[model samples]
Target: MTQYWYNVRTHQVEEDAMSDWTQLIGPYPTREEAEQALEKVKERNKSWDPNDTDGDGWADHD
Candidate 1:
């Protein structure tokens, strides 16, 4: 079975195992929706750093 993964922080979509654990920012079925959701998350969290020294490279809300 194929699964989809979406990053609430970056709104990046992919086919991976972690998709199940990821928070569904929206019921979005399209890439644009996911992108919009990611933007919303970014806007809500101003301190989020998309580029960090961490290996994950995920933006964190401080």
Candidate 2:
């Protein structure tokens, strides 16, 4: 019962943290497959800018 998590803010694949905010995107059997899916999501949302200092773009919410 492997699980995968994605950071929507950074659009990066994260190891299973199982937190309240980790956002479970998939429950794949293999880590490779989970990473692949994460890559696809990144591709679709290529404009993700996680470090916009001006606050006009994605903000680092923690």
- Best model per lDDT: 2
TM-score of 1: 0.34
Question: How far is 10's C-alpha from truth in model 1 (Å)?
Answer: 8.4
Model 2 residue 23 CA deviation (Å) reads 1.7
Per-residue lDDT, model 1, residue 14, is 56
> What TM-score does each of the candidates earn?
0.34, 0.36
**Candidate 2 local Cα displacement, residue 54, angstroms:** 26
lDDT of 2 by residue, 1-62 (tens): 54666555565565664544645566556667666765566554545755544544444556
Among all windows of 10 consecutive residues in model 2, the one with the lowest summed lDDT is 51-60
User: Looking at model 1, how many pairs of residues clash?
Assistant: 0
lDDT of 1 by residue, 2-55 (tens): 444466555576554355554555545665555566555555554455454352
After superposition, the stretches of candidate 2 with alpha carbons farther than 4 Å from their true spots are 7-17, 39-62
Off by over 4 Å in 1: 1-5, 8-11, 14-18, 46-62
